[model samples]
Target: MFTRCWLWIGRLLRRTLLITLSAGLASGAIGYCYYSLKFSGPVSAEEQIPATEAADSRAIIEDAIRVVEQHRSDTRVLRDAHAKAHGCVKAEVSVLSELPSNLSYGVFSQPGKTWQAWMRLSNGNAYPQFDRARDARGMAIKLLEVEGEKLLGSRSEQDFVMFNHPSFFVRDVAEYRQNFAAQANGQQVLAFLPGWDPRHWEVRHLLIALQTLSPAPETPLASTYNSIAPFKLGPIASKYRVIPSPENCPSYTPPAQNRDLPNFLRNALYQQLSIDRVDACFALQVQLQDPTHFMPIEDPSVEWDEALAPFVTVAKIRVAAQDFDSREQNLFCDNLAFNPWQALPEHRPLGGINRLRKEVYEAVNVYRHQRNQQSQTP
Candidate 1:
């Protein structure tokens, strides 16, 4: 009777184990199928810009620059006042790594290894007393080593960029402007939603979901970084991407406090430099299809058809260990401006938002820099 009971119990256990294994396998397969269907789409070539549109874009940018210069006096005073209100600190720094081969705006390569770089890391909002921990961070890098045809005679090759989610909030220029206007108009909530808000829901939700899955600051940075701008490549155009290697540097759980993020990243970077002299590499990818055939250009809310133009590794960017934040590294230089228009003729930025940027970026930077300089004089 005992032997018979033992045989029955073994049969029951085997059935339960088999059922669980089958369920797990089924779930995984379904998930894989869903993603495969989602990201894999068809590819096509991009369209050429009409002559009228190109001329109009250039004129708008030129006019805007002129207007900005006219108001430079008032802008300077306002900037000085702001600096006085908030104790401004300045610092000078240098780049420790070599730039990628295709770093030039065009074929013109500026000569110089060492560059006087300035940077500023700040929250998205303009509140001076805002908690650094709670706000989104910004990073700008200005290379004093740059030389080119002066866009309004500025001698610096400034890349005013930021570290937000991997993808951008908007896909094209028109949407980017609308989103910018909303932010400037004190509609903070509008920045996060669709209609009046410029935020891309898909990208935002994906990021929020990622945070819930792994609530860490480093996780977002570790993933791929992309240039939302539709950049030109010969006759083909694409959105650029930079992916970090997870193989060398494994992802870690982030500490709870928000303010600790910058420091944590700084420390991690320092530790890597101390040991292996860390090299962060990202490859450039381009979309080879007509914008109209895939995603809507004016809507910053939706993602481009990734299925059409899968990311192909083109260039590699490697950042070395060096203190990026120092006293002389003011926010202006450190928070380098990266305009889509600041490109080679081959990689000219596409869409309406990029056209607007050719003006807005130049105006904002010139205004901000002029003010900072005046305040430093006294």
Candidate 2:
């Protein structure tokens, strides 16, 4: 079955490659395509919907571990899926002074409360690559000195993870398993193929993957990111997002094109925080799920209709002027791990993908920390 899938992918790539090359000379879309190819928003106001576990979830997690371990073996370094770190900077997450009753939950429960944080911006790639390469971007915020028992460990910290896109490509454990298997074989394209398994095909997923791997952002601070999966916000469920304050954050235009400066994203960030001494601000907003509507907890691929439930700003994230590019700081950022499960029970991660993450993320985190000879977070 795998051989047959490989042959089909080979044939498709062969045809598409030629057409892409021919079309590249004119459109530049295909030209950009020729250069390289790669790589959610989440919300809700209704009651918390519990997630169901797939029978094969354990096997799927094991397969994911294998995939991560394979990457570690190949690079001789343990790393997360989002392996390329752009930068990690000091910041603060401050709950707004006045949030409505419905919006008041978990971290936002105490209005005006502030928690110091570390924000790590990264490329969502299996390996470190040029920043110019088209891929998904990540913004992981870890709040420190938070007074709550974490779901993962006995840490007084909380983590909120987000991606630039609104929805995830993989819907369930089965699709996730297929994706990891493809990654294990070093053929990510196989995960998006029409018929990786004879009985199954994922055209929508393939298109979503293509869209997810859209153009890289100029600077990490200038882009909006969504928590593409749903999570608990006390009694109700919600999806949160980080929206950069355009008025406060300056847009960065590199002196040279992306081709000339492969690490332009990092350079842009450095310029804003270090050289320019500009402070960056972002609105932390949440959209509650509606119980009347069908917001599938099992399938993260289906985006909840934002029109029905709008996001309300509940907090602000502010990054003051500071240099985070030093070797010590970068190493600390590299060693740090962020997981949705590293949160209060009030903000528990939902859905099969998140459930899968509970196991898969832990396996990789433990392995990576062990390999690096570092202590696990308490």
Candidate 3:
């Protein structure tokens, strides 16, 4: 079954590779082909909805939340599908002050203050896959002892979750159902749904927009991570990023087909940790709310050009040398929740995708705790 799964995934990836090649020469016909598949009509400036109307995401949020609930495991040990965190290590974040402004939000508002954080790196697939295979990786950072009014009740931690890619596949909650459907079938051991295109270019541009720079990463420490969605920085809106900057230990590529171990990535992380302390720095960039050219806050699909508004360094994150690949720490990391909403009110997650995450994450958090037979909050 594992061999068959690998072959099946290989076939699907070959198709994506072809798409990637064709993407290099983006033509008018290709654009028309994508436009033809739009459920919400042609993509246009007029099609972009306001931040408020786009916030009417309750129905999709509830429906998708129910789907995840139905997929719950009966054991106290299983993890939430997608971003199955395999490693959690001790880390710290130093919040460097940005230019003084009334607009600076949340953790950024009080610059120069340091906060202890836990860094959890995970594979994007719900079910484990070979590290050699192409897949999304996750970097979730939880800034502890944060002092601010909370977005959901009184939570002292500010969580900034990011993916290796800067853009997400789906644009809104309504499209999340389709994305979930693909995932539900793709993870099955036996077969995938017919025409299962997780990178449905016609449906969304993320297939091209958000593909990882590396098909497979040597370690989580090697890749830069992006929040993908916008957040309120005090009164201003911005996105979060983490760039890897370890001296001497550069990111590398693993063998194209090394399927001997299911925990290859974890092993790689442990190997890196054993060598020396890991270092990564975080950046906060303001989003320009251009209602005409770029809908900064709402449509995250509109990739913000770094040349226009470069991300400024707001914090430096360091992961000290430690053993991270242990059953105890892995389980603890699994139990630990890192929701964007688990943040300061000043840094409340902004935009439609973020708005949906507020409810979806809460639902998943409750579901995971119940399945694990443990009630813990972060």
On TM-score, the candidate that comes out on top is 2
Against the correct fold, how does model 3 do in TM-score? Answer: 0.74
> In terms of lDDT, which candidate is strongest?
2
Candidate 1 vs candidate 2, TM-score winner: 2
Model 2: lDDT to the true structure: 0.79
Going through the candidates in order, what is the number of backbone clashes in each?
Answer: 28, 13, 3
Rate residue 45 of model 3 by lDDT. Answer: 26
Q: Residues 244-349, candidate 3, lDDT per residue (tens digit)?
A: 6544234444333244677677776676565444433334334433333343565676566665556676666777667777777777787898889998777778
Stretches of candidate 1 exceeding 4 Å from the true structure: 1-163, 166-186, 190-216, 219-223, 246-271, 274-277, 290-292, 296-298, 330-332, 335-337, 374-378
**Candidate 2 lowest-lDDT run of ten:** 35-44
Could you give the candidate ranking by lDDT, starting with the highest?
Answer: 2, 3, 1
> TM-scores for all candidates?
0.52, 0.81, 0.74
The positional error of residue 322 in candidate 2, measured at the CA in angstroms, is 0.5
Name the 10 consecutive residues with the lowest summed lDDT in model 3.
38-47
Give the Cα-based TM-score of candidate 1 against the true structure: 0.52
Q: Which candidate model has the greater TM-score, 2 or 3?
A: 2
Q: After superposition, how far is residue 88 of candidate 2 from its true place, in Å?
A: 0.8
